[model samples]
Target: MTTTASVQVYTTNYCPYCTRAKQLLTKRGIAFEEIDVSNDDEKRAWLVKTTGQRTVPQIFIQGSPIGGSDELHQLDRSGELAKRLAAA
Candidate 1:
């Protein structure tokens, strides 16, 4: 099933990890809303407040934070991400 809410990605332009994370989501055919935090200090601060970490490529699936690129990749490798997407 397709989820009611779209996926979200918080990122910056120069972050390689962010690129990698976007590629993964793209490869899965999952469309997402990307929030670039490079210039917006308030957005960056909100990201930190919501995610509790200072990092690029903070992902959220159905409003739940999935963490950074590494964590997202881990989820993919372990098949959890796939499962979630399929269930959506």
Candidate 2:
């Protein structure tokens, strides 16, 4: 499927969830921008404030926050991820 939505993923170096999330996106042929917050305290704090989640692999689609890996997988399972991406 072709994706028009811009995807951003906030991740950490040692987080397995981050890897899984990226792998899923890759498998689906979805392009994403990965932001590593492993060493940046400012970015991490901003992520927490923006996403309301103190976890790695926070994802955003078309500038809308979409939670983490499990949420992403759930959307995929529910067939909502493509629908969201296809939204203009």
Candidate 3:
């Protein structure tokens, strides 16, 4: 059986890390939902509520928060990202 993973990225305009994060996902052929918190107050609040941090590019796969870009890169390096993507 094959399952499609749902990835969500909470981001803002001009965040270089956000761009890099998206590039990484795109390079992996992963589709994702991008939320722009650049000017949306409600979105910002929601991001903070869900992640407990005001960081751009808060990623979630299968409804699990995977943290910011740095954390994501770490996961990729440690080989856990593949596992998560597979699970998704």
Candidate 4:
């Protein structure tokens, strides 16, 4: 990761938004830990329980939920994602 923020993204292999999210983060030079929960029921369950969202590509920055693909795009568009990613 370029920044000190610990970014974790929960994703499924077949999710297009997951790919987009990764691409956006990579384009911003942000590195993240991607958890592939495609076949892992336990991890998926855990993600849902923690995030309250049963969708793929649940993203976290420094353990703070930043929401999914559209939210990420919105953050990037509003220049907040860069600020957050650049944060410690």
1-88, model 4: which lDDT tens digit per residue?
A: 3666788989988999999999998887788899999999999888888989999899999998888999999998998987887774
Off by over 4 Å in 1: 1-5
Candidate 3 per-residue C-alpha lDDT over 1-88 given as tens digits, one digit per residue, 9 for 90 to 100: 2236888998999899999999888777778889888999998898889889988989999888999899989998998988888876
Q: Per-residue alpha-carbon lDDT of model 1 for 1-88, expressed as tens digits?
A: 2334568999999999999999988887778899998999999999899999999989998889989999989998998987877666
True lDDT of residue 71, candidate 1:
94
Task: For each candidate in the order shown, give its overall lDDT on alpha carbons.
Answer: 0.87, 0.93, 0.87, 0.89
> Total backbone clashes of model 3?
0
All models, RMSD in angstroms: 2.1, 0.8, 2.2, 1.5
Q: Please, what is the TM-score per model?
A: 0.89, 0.96, 0.90, 0.91
Backbone clash tally for model 4? 0
Error at 71, model 2, angstroms: 0.0
Stronger candidate by lDDT (2 vs 3): 2
The per-residue C-alpha lDDT of model 1 at residue 2 equals 33
| Tens digit per residue, CA lDDT, model 2, 35-86 | 9999999999999899899998999998899999999999999999998998
Give the winner by TM-score: 2
lDDT score, candidate 4, position 63: 91
Clashing pairs in 3: none
Predict model 3's lDDT versus the native: 0.87
